[model samples]
Target: VGRIKTAPACSHVPELPEVETCRRALAPRLAGRTLTDAVTPWPRAAATPLVVTGRCIVRLDRRGKFLLLRLDRGWLVIHLRMTGRLVVVRELPPRTTAAFQLDGDEWFCLVDVRKFGRAWQVARASEVVGHLGPEPLSRHFTAARFSAMLAPRRARLKPLLLNQRFLAGLGNIYVDESLHAARIHPLRTANTLSTGEVRRLHRYIRTILRAAITEGGTTIQNFAGPDGKPGRFRSRLQVFRRSGEACGGCGTIIERSVVAQRGTHFCPHCQRL
Candidate 1:
């Protein structure tokens, strides 16, 4: 893998991989711990925050980009929007919108500069994430199902993939990267893809997401692991923000356009529209 000192400023909200990284780090530290207290400097950070106080955490789970803290009584669902960071530390970090007093002298904090992050206490996690479509990495999301699902959509591929109600856990970064890898143009209409193209797209979506999770996610902007490390996967990105650079596959300069109101990067030679 290549090495980069910092990620570019082009990436958007935390996707499945970034949220998953946070979940993996928090699960071990907080699974059995009781929520001693819940405090939010920003009042909008959590809804019914105190409801979770004194509840024992069952486990840390993630659906799409939301972190589900399964409590003995209810679920504490958190969505780390555009600029949310979940960290466990001895002292509260700067920009701490909300902090939970965890056992073992650690603090589970949501440090968000944008303040777009939100947490909720609910009887069912589906209250927040129930409408989301199938997880791309789940075994049940087979190519046949994906193909069938696409057959009815008339939307563009990039926008359709980014829609959580269609397929969960994808954001601008992964969708662009996956589409480029699958040799599918972002502006292509969903129902126009052939069976082989659908299969390839499905495979690359799963593969890229898994690899990104392994590298701690693509830190295009303010993302960082619970350990305070920027994602290594940025070094492996093919065409998300490499506009004006040579295409690795065909040596043609990569291009950029607006699709679904988001900046899209792709190789004109590799991903002909």
Candidate 2:
């Protein structure tokens, strides 16, 4: 096997919206198809390639930031950690980490410039995804439930929102965008948020995520859909990468700061401490 080269650390990793967009693009073409063969040029990219061959993909589902492909005998889970992408084509593209030959002469390819992607074949999907918190867009994630989840946590708002167990599917981008939309400071303590603030946060979280998905997810640099088209949501971003730009809500310039060890963007006048 040839050595697989990893891409540099990405500043804009795929959040829930991007992963969900990939799921949506892949489900129609992948569902009900059987994998006649599987190849992984990088062993590290796929955990159980042996189990992936010859299995029928019953469905494709998304949980938080993970993509779950329901196979006849087990589940095929994929996580595009950074710079990882799934594309379908007649011929596999360069930097292909893994490729699955579908029944209809189509190819489902995992290409990662950074080589940080992962794939797993498991007997139970829950084995991999059971620990994640509620899906933010699901009916189960009610405002009352969100308040209950935040009531006892003292962690900073941004990091707490990024926690998969606290609220699955949020990464730095959406957290910053959502926080700006709600006008809540990233450093605010979870337990310190007033009831109204918590409610507003909850509303904006879902709102921003849904809107991003509708726009096909945000593309900061290398992100693209299975069709290999850049996402339109990047054009709609208000603060994630708008550092030093005038705030959309207030005239104050957006500032960048480090929170949770990740570069964060917010408007000081809008998202005050």
Candidate 3:
């Protein structure tokens, strides 16, 4: 629920592919415009204030899945929670539950029914720089770096991947899919993966993420690209919430279990420890 509380602030879990997806969705809208105005109706509520009013949106980029709005003065970083989606096509009506909105992205709406998403209007880049880790697809997020992150922690691998500080932009769906892809148990100790397994893990992370993005980001709930079509990727998902169904690869009945309290799915025979 804590993660969900950050939902309105969540932006597609900022995965390598989702970040790229958001970049595509937001870039065209912001390319030649300036965030000429900023306001927050509820100042004390969880919100991102207008931080760089006079600055033009220099570049729209992503560090992991978090959308970074580079301005001449500072930055605006957004993390869309479970229901969080960065849209570009319409001026949506004010959701009774919307947390906030940024005018720059044609319509930046933080619409989480549970009010879990957040926005940061920042005058200083340092505000969020300390919060995110290396991009999984960046040249620096190597096997060596992935391996090193796990060496010191005794935590279960699943939750560790969900931790932004550990390595930003992974979430329940990708964690489940990646673990199953690597054929590793979700409960495996972070430090125990072999070099080969780590290599497979890296490959699977990108593959699953990129595949999901190509299909328009999974919409098991509220995710949708600028087109408003539901994400088709959920139909292609291998094991996330596919319990009681045949595994796509081996036809074994997929199963569900608890790992770090997040209900998880995997093919028992294909994803054994």
Q: Which residue pairs collide in model 2, if any?
A: 6-114, 7-114
Stretches off by above 4 angstroms in model 3 are 1-16, 41-48, 89-92, 96-107, 222-226
Show model 2 residue runs off by greater than 4 Å.
Answer: 1-12, 222-227
C-alpha RMSD for every candidate: 5.0, 4.6, 6.0
Order of the predicted models by TM-score, top scorer first? 1, 2, 3
Between candidates 1 and 3, the lDDT winner: 1
Candidate 3's clash total is: 17
Give lDDT tens digits, candidate 3, residues 110-138. Answer: 54444444567677665875678777767
* TM-score of every candidate: 0.93, 0.92, 0.83
Q: Report RMSD for candidate 3.
A: 6.0
Model 3 scores a C-alpha lDDT of: 0.67
| Model 2, span 1-273: residue lDDT tens | 433222111123788998888788778778899898888887789876555667899999999999999898989898888788887776777888988888877778888888888888899989888999999999989989999999999899988888998889999899999999999999998998888998999999999999998988888886433336677898899998889889989889999999879999999988878
Which digits, one per residue and each the tens of the lDDT, describe model 1 over residues 12-62? 368999888778867877889988888899989977645666899999888
lDDT of the candidates, in the order given: 0.85, 0.84, 0.67
Is 2 or 3 the stronger prediction by TM-score? 2
Residue 76, model 1: lDDT of: 92
